[model samples]
Target: MDPLLLLFSLSAATCAYLLWFYLLARNLTGPKVWPVFGSLPYLFLNRKRMHDWIASNLCSTGGAATYQTCTIALPFLARRQGFYTVTCHPKNIEHVLRTRFDNYPKGPTWQTAFHDLLGQGIFNSDGDTWLIQRKTAALEFTTRTLRQAMARWVNRTIRTRLWVILDKAARDHTPVDLQDLLLRLTFDNICGLTFGKDPETLSPEMPENPFAIAFDTATEATLQRLIYPGFLWRLKKVLMIGSEDRLKKSLQIVENYMNEAIDARKEKPSDDLLSRFLKKRDMDGNLFPISVLQRIALNFVLAGRDTSSVALSWFFWLVMNHARVEEKILRELKTVLTESRGGEPKRWMEEPLTFDEAEKLTYLKAALAETLRLYPSVPEDFKYVITDDVLPDGTFVPAGSTVTYSIYSVGRMKAIWGEDCMEFRPERWLTAGGDRFEPPKDGYKFVAFNAGPRTCLGKDLAYLQMKSVASAVLLRYRLSTVPGHRVEQKMSLTLFMKNGLRVYLHPRTLA
Candidate 1:
């Protein structure tokens, strides 16, 4: 055949396949599919509120639904072809994430995207490797020495450094973007704990930091991979494309910085987390290699940095929108402080607040939980089927299908959370006895921190960070939203404000 004829024939076949897929999908009574694009076009149409769009589509087409006979752009890659996506239905989630869990793994596609950034760390590994990493991480996280170090580090950073900057802004009657401030604060604190050096991006001056920029670029690239077609990704890699080049540059910057920090820490040992890991050995009596240490550091930086900051940012935004909630939080803070300081206003900067003191603020903890219920940092997560399985609801999912659980949508589901599910009501978290409501045993019903064996390991640490920061700031300064600021959620791995949260703070005076 002539070259022109061959090219025309290939295009004709692709169009025929797409047309057949559309007709076949339309006949099935589930989520609708568009020719050539499948549900991707619908996702792009409502990219801003993709989570809500997916949930609404799922609810409209029965609670547990799938889009059959869809076409992904990349048909050559067997693993990336014709994926089946699922949303949050309790039984469905339980089947995939908990019951018959061994039949589902994070899958090769997911690992490929994150492996470059996280290496072989816990977040990217499975089987014996995952078990080993999780066990080691759990042990280190719960140690008395590490716990004490983390407490001291958080107190100094939040109480001493961050509040000082916020105090100055308040005194000057300046509006601060709490989102940016929280990111810097968490980044610096994570760095100090992990590497024993402070990036100091949280300072009032706010110097331009290269590591922060590179880290942001890496995260953006990872998100892009989620939406882009697999063939395009591979082609870009082969063609020396700019997107791949930029990703490499960003990763190089992070790697170089981590290597230098590891070298410095090795030369002069410190009591930081990295040093502690370096000093300890596995059951084989062999210390973790530098490469493994680097991988661990990368995982810590990526996992610990954005999620907490984003969560706290949303928490403050929710409080600002609901004044009644803010007043209740303030009242709780005052009561906790009074109890802690023996009827006196606790002095800041001069004395560090103990972890026990921070933990005693029951209302503060409840407020944090409510914030998580509204805006889970990780809005959704993906898994792939390893074996053909039937859900408890009798929805048959074939092997190699992709499954997604929408944490954000689950938070807003009326069937799960009652009629005021969409409202920002912290009282929902309060018991009739006026104490904080304990989370349910089967957490799939309210899976902000996720449930089962894969639940977040840093849940306790995150709460501690939020309570400490919120307590210190709310006690000393009153924050109100800037007028005309449209704060809406952004859809990334974590939920952040589309427009950065702008709030004006005024120093509170004791009467």
Candidate 2:
């Protein structure tokens, strides 16, 4: 047999196989897929701007109503069996989140990835574990005492620490990292509300808090487990190297702080969430174990700290860009001040808004809502499919596949929010009279807090905290972004500003 003839035969067979694979993947609406490598190359290339990349792919297929769902096929990576069905379609999101709620839990991959950081906490657990915690938390959140406790923490932080720092910055004419400041402010606030202990990350010196640093390290390392292949992270864990190694040290610091706080709470219970959780019994009529309590405290911090701060950061940046919206918010604040405090701008600027006063900030609330629509803290969320299911848009997702609903993409969809969806118009959220705030009736359309049974229990609390901080800052100071400073999004579990919101503060004066 001639060697050239044999080589020609093999080459022909390879071409035939490649042609078949291309034909099969041609109809799929997602990033370009390659043989063997699948979409890995494309994903790696666009990793920095993943959310926008996904939105572009979905939009290119067709707008929301036509082709709102797309598939990403990965040949390796055992999680979700290497198949992901990403969708921003409201109907499909509703079906996955509400109608077939039981069919989708946080699932094993998510639980496993976050177990060291979150344990069997409500956010990480499924079934009975999550249900019991949710029921208990729901009850506690509804209590006026808890809300009052949160208010006290928030007001004290603003009046004592945040205002002083911002005032100093204004006086010195120095640019400050508002995002970093907000992160510290919220961290202190959340720690106080969660465990009755404040790390005081927002102090005058703006010193580093070991506990806060450890928690951030741990959270970031844990997220790496989700991004890298399951086996890769697991092997790193076994070897005690890389991000897994950092996770171990960070977890130790986090646990120590939590244990100390838990011991203190046990000795003398306070009005914080930790004290309330300590008083409650678990599934087996037992007090939650030390381990469980630690995770619960960490979970609340993880939820309360990042989301509110990130949302506030984006809100400030948006307001800084849109002066018309800022003027409207100021006018509304002035109206509220006039009605309640004899219209003294100077006196009002001296103090933070009380919880009751923050409630009167309806337009400001709408602006915050508008900000969240465009920049959700958690831009994308993935749910694992339990049984084989058919989505509302006639797409079939297998039992082991993962479905990621893009909250960021939803805000950009023309079909869902009309042609002006991309515009930063708070008026869309207001009533015709412009006096009252109103959100879309469809829960799925605005899922920054998510929808259905798994909706955020801290929804009202988040609003309260944001309103308090937002009103406090805006009333006292006018924020201007630093010239030539770029604002870019960080690709993470949360939507953080990559460069931080660098701004100079100008003290507002009565005209």
Candidate 3:
């Protein structure tokens, strides 16, 4: 009896809601952020191109912008929102990371998302927990003992596992995913250094390791959580579906591996990183529980594994692209090796590269640093604002707001790096004398390993490891990418080359 009247009423309600949403959405300045979804409409449309999209927006607003992702509820009744004050400004990076350091921490959002994987580990925890872990790590990382162990591990792994694999690939003329080889190398090296166990992940056969596979799965899934809202992800988590399911099983695999490693360490009690960690107790003088030990293990594994492998993969890719860079690196390598070995080229290849010898590869270190500048493994990270704060760039961040600084975007910013920022040039890092490599004086400017008190503890070790591998590989073989193999970045906690770095290897003759 009233069908026509009901239809008119429904139409009028729709018009009212549209008018209300339209009024609220117009206040957004940078992009046409839609109501409820905020910047997500544009973000969703450009998900594949996020790094560039974000850089484009940051460039539009003088290198800073207030991006919002609101709940899709009724306009006035919006439940919660994700207000990301994203900045690519270096001054703002210093302000948040150093000058006003106390104002920011990993925060609840990051901790919550990474909790399952990282737990109260160094990367996830804030406050006292973070301090304790940092101190403990500082102790382990700075030790000459650990550095010696790391050098042995790297040299042995490269000479034994990596060399044999590449030799086979070169002999067979087989195309290999260099990224996979590097990942295996790092995984084997880290597992031996950290767990007092060797997974032998870099063997010539290149078989799959479940722990490595699961680690990759869990990290990528968790990275996805950063983009999803709490409600949507929390509901998926509750239902045991989708990414949550993958995360659940992956963590299970990772935790089991950790526990198994711990048991082996306890039974044997060798002097690896795990043994050192095992001996340390909490502030209460009680030995850490298995859970704590697992986090420690996972934390170190995560740090030691991805960062070096990803860095090397990118470094090799960059070096291959620039013949001049490769030639310069080779010349430096020959000079350093010949000089170090008393002009004995054959002995340089035959003998193991020690810490003292690797330390002399200044140009190699410079090349790696330059690669990190353009493509940092951990490209993006964020902090939570504790109180109302004014960034150095004059952006106002309110309490309970989130601020994410993209190291990826920072490296590409012309304002900080000059007009040639886009160009891959290792010479930029070299000093005026053009002989020694000098990093940016400001922490925030070269933020690949982070900055200030939270600087990466493994920085020195990373350099030592990368230089050793690069030297060993270059002395034996010339690596070129497999033709028609696409290289792209995988969306993950680490800046992994999505398609993997596939390469063809040609053996270099010492004669």
RMSD of each: 3.2, 2.8, 2.8
Pairs of residues at least 3 apart in sequence or in different chains that clash in candidate 2: none
lDDT per residue for candidate 3 within 1-511, as digits (tens), equals 5999999999998999788877655543456656557666776787676776766776666544334333343554332246677776778888888888888998988889899999988888888888878898899888898998888889888878888888888999998888998898889889999988899888977789999999999998888788767777789999989999999999999988998999999989886888888988877778888998899888888999999999999999998899899888888878877877767677878856787888887778888988998899998888988898887766667777688887888778777788998888988888888788788876577888988789999999999898888888888788888888888887778888989999988988764
Question: What would the TM-scores of all predictions be?
Answer: 0.91, 0.94, 0.93
What does candidate 1's lDDT look like per residue over 1-511, in tens digits? 9999999999999888776664556554445566556667766677788777766766565444433334353344222455665666776787777887787788877788777777777777777667766777787787777767778778888766788788788878888889999999889988988889888898868887888998888777777666655666767767857667677889899889899889989998887778877886655778888887888887888778888899899888877678887787777766766776655564532455578777776777777887887788888888878877777766666677677777777767776676887788776666767776566555677777777777777778878878888877776777889899888878676787888889999877642
Which one is best on TM-score? 2
Q: Which whole-number lDDT from 0 to 100 does residue 44 have in model 2?
A: 71
What are the runs in model 1 whose C-alpha is more than 4 Å off?
1-31, 62-80, 279-286, 346-352
Model 3: residue 198 alpha-carbon error in angstroms: 0.7
Candidate closer to the true structure by lDDT (higher is better), 2 or 3: 2
Model 3, 237: alpha-carbon shift in Å?
Answer: 1.2
Ten-residue region with minimum lDDT total, candidate 1: 71-80
Tell me the tens digit of each residue's lDDT in model 2 across 264-328. Answer: 99998888999989988877899899999999999999999999999999999999989999999
